[model samples]
Each structure stands twice: as structure tokens, then as C-alpha cells.
Target: MSYLTLFLTAFAAATLLPAYSEILLGTLASQDYPLFWLWFWATAGNTLGSVVNGIIGRQVDRFKDRRWFPVSETQLHKARNRFNRYGQWSLLLGWLPIGGDALTLVGGIMRVPWLNFVILVAIGKGLRYAFVIWVVLKAGAMAT
Candidate 1:
């Protein structure tokens, strides 16, 4: 049940919706939950959430002209320019806050291959969770 909660939180965090999984991961780590599963579930959930953004991005172009469209033309244009400048490699930064989600979306808009998208996102998010886990464990060690 705890792992499920963490997975869901991590998944939601990766989406455009506001959520944070790092804090939960840290809390669980300090409690001494299984480290590998915690990292695995968090990374998997987060990476899958970014995949959702990519999927939306692929279809979002058609909706840009609608009144309910969330992004302005100028904003989309600027995002496009930045994505193009950085190319697909920019997906590596999809783990970043704020701009990270947008980067994944732009990756879809630019039609980055799906395999590359998943692999890159997984790597970045996995590394982030690993760092978080390491920090929590290290801190706990010092406290003891």
C-alpha cells in the first residue's frame, strides 16, 4: 500500500498537475522501506507521467486555435524555438521542475521518437530518485 501511494504520487508529480514525490520518497527512506522498490516505483511512475504529457503534446497542435486553448501562439512559438535549438537531447532535462514538464510536451510536439522519449525520461527521473534516496539514507546515517 505504501509503495502504491508513492507510485501514484510520483506519477501525478510528473504530470502538469502539481505534485511532489521527492518528499514522500525521503520520508519513506528515513523509515527504512525497501530502497530498490521505492526507487523503481517512483521512477517508473514519474517516467510514465511524462509519457502522458508527450501523448498530449502529439495531439495538442489541432486544439491550438480553440478558445479554450491553454497556450498562446507566442508561447508555443517560443517553446518550439527552444526545443529546436536544443534538439531531442533536451529531453534529458525533463527531470527539472517547472520547465521539465513543458520540455516533455515539446518533445511530443516535435515528434521525438517514442523509444527515445521513454528511455531518456526514465534515465533522468531514475537518477533523480536515486539521488534523493542516497541523500535521505546518508542523512539518517549521520543522525544515528
Candidate 2:
């Protein structure tokens, strides 16, 4: 289903990996997919992926020895401090690459309330999908 594809793409994109969710969204939109379902699926998938990052961040101590990540405890502490104070504003630009997932994990590390994090993340994710849908729909409308 188109929703499945969108969800998968969005999920992968939200993780620490490269994915083309925007392309998938554009293709689905061009094919006249059910907008609401498509939007819901994408937002849910992306948000879940971000949550995974949060889970990992909560256990950040385990990864403190890793060379690849290289994020020191002191730095993480500083980040968490800043994150806890400005979590909502951080969610506002969740569409930006890299920052989105990082913010999510940092939020968990900063002990952001679960409900507030999810709600703000949903709003940000919803707007992202809506923008994608609007752009694809507009392009299709102009083409036709």
C-alpha cells in the first residue's frame, strides 16, 4: 500500500540513516493516495523512529566507550541541560536533517515529559508531511 511505503520511508529517514521519504511522498501524492491515511502513517513512523533514538540516548552511558559516537558525558550533560529548557522550540524545526533525531534523544536524556514530547513531535511531523503533500499536489496540478 502507498501508506506502507510512506511509513517505511519516513521511518528510515528519521533514523541515523539516509532515506528518500520526500521522494516517496511525492510519488504517492502524484498517484492520488488517501491524504489523511498517508499523512498519519508517515508522521507515526517518523515519530517512532525518533523515539528509538530517545531510548538509545537514555542508555547513553553504555555507549560512552564507543569511538564512532564520541559524544562525551560532559557534552551530553550540557546538551541535555539546554534541551530540557527549549524542547518545544527544538521540536518546531524537526524537519531539518540531523537535528530532528538528535533533538529527540537529547530530549529523553534531558528528561522531557513523555506526553509533551510526543505531542510536540506529532505536530512537527504532521506539518512536515502536510508540506510534502501540498508541494507534490501543487506540482501535479500544474502538470495537468
Candidate 3:
């Protein structure tokens, strides 16, 4: 159940939603939960959530002309420019808090390959969770 909660939190954090999973991860780490499962579930859930955003980006154009479209042409244009400037390499920063979701969405808009997207996103998010776990463990050790 804890793992499931962590997974859900990680997944929600990866999306445009305002969710934060780091605190839970830190708490779980301090409680001595298995590190591998925590990292695996978090990475997997977050990556899948980013993929969902990518899928939405892929289909956004169909509704782009509608008045209800969320993104403006100017915003999309700027996003495209930044994406092109950084290239798919920017996908590696998908674990970042700000602009990260946009990076995944823009990757889809630019048609980044699925394999590449998954690999980069997973690597980035995995590293982030690993670092968080490491920090918690180190802090816990220092306190003892």
C-alpha cells in the first residue's frame, strides 16, 4: 500500500498537476522501505505519466484551431523554438520541477521517438529518485 501510494504520487507529480512526491520518498526512505522498489515504482509511474502528456501533445493539434484550445499559437511557437534550440536532449531534464512537463509535451509535438522518450525520461526520473533516497539515507545516518 505504501508503494502504491508512492507510485501514484510520483505519477501525479510528473503530470501538469501540482503534486510533490519527494517528501513521501524521503519519509519512506527514513522508515527503511526497500530502496529498489521505491525507485522502480517512482520512476515507472512518473515516466508513464509523462508519456500520457506526450500522447496529449500528439493529439493537441486537432483541436488547436478551436477557441477552447488551451495553448495559444504564440505560446506554442515559443515552446517549439525553445525545444528546437535544446533538441531532444532536453528530455533528459524531464525530472525538473518547472518546465519539465512542457518538455515532455513539446517532445511529442516535435515527434520524438517513443523509445528515446522512454529511455531519457526514465533515466532522468530514476536518477532523481535515487538522489532523493541517497540524501535521506545520508541525513538519517548523520542523525544517528
**Steric clash count of candidate 3:** 0
Clashing pairs in 1: none
Model 1 Cα lDDT, one tens digit per residue, 1-144: 999999999999999788999999999988868899999999999999999999999997899989999999999999999999989899988999869999999999988999999999999999999999999989988999
In the range 46-118, model 2's lDDT, one tens digit per residue, is 8887777767777787777788876986888788777767655686556677678888777666656677777
Q: Highest TM-score: which candidate?
A: 3
Q: Order of candidates by TM-score, top first?
A: 3, 1, 2
TM-score per prediction, in order, is 0.96, 0.86, 0.97
lDDT measured at residue 35 in model 3 versus the true structure, 0 to 100: 91
Model 1 bad stretches (over 4 Å) = none
Off by over 4 Å in 3: none
